[model samples]
Target: MKPSVSRSESSARCPRCGNAFDCAMHGQPFDCWCREMPPLPADRLDSSGRCLCPECLAAEIARVAQGRPRGA
Candidate 1:
């Protein structure tokens, strides 16, 4: 089953560590932890409509930027 969305604000979960938190709580700009890192594809949204966390998103960005192939 999908998790219910909260009305407080949007948050992100680390794909690597499975840590869930708000970007603002982490002193970030966007509503997700990935705010401090980089932008993602238009399809990265979760069922509840939230972005991935910074660490997970950053790693993906870095891997792509480095041309290290996908899913690195």
Candidate 2:
């Protein structure tokens, strides 16, 4: 279930860290900013449909590269 983003920007919180962030997936002049990040592995993608903050997202990608399980 993709997070219920509107046709414009919205304020959101990272479900993992509870950090506040802005989502611009459907904002003016551009696509989502997460597109800037490398694609996450299908198995590693979050199931919650909420977007992760940059730090947590980078950590997740690193964990995938290191072959570590989540939270390890």
Q: Kindly give the number of clashing pairs for every candidate.
A: 0, 0
lDDT by candidate, in order shown: 0.54, 0.75
lDDT of 2 by residue, 1-72 (tens): 244443333667778777766777557866767888888887777787778877788889889889899856
Which predicted model would earn the best lDDT? 2
* Per-candidate TM-score against the hidden true structure: 0.46, 0.73
Q: What is the Cα-based TM-score of model 1?
A: 0.46
User: Candidate 2: where are CA atoms >4 Å away?
Assistant: 1-9, 28-30
Worst ten in a row by lDDT for model 2: 1-10
Q: Model 1: residues >4 Å from true position, as ranges?
A: 1-9, 23-36, 41-50
lDDT of 1 by residue, 1-72 (tens): 233254335465544466764556444443433444666554443456544556566776777668675565
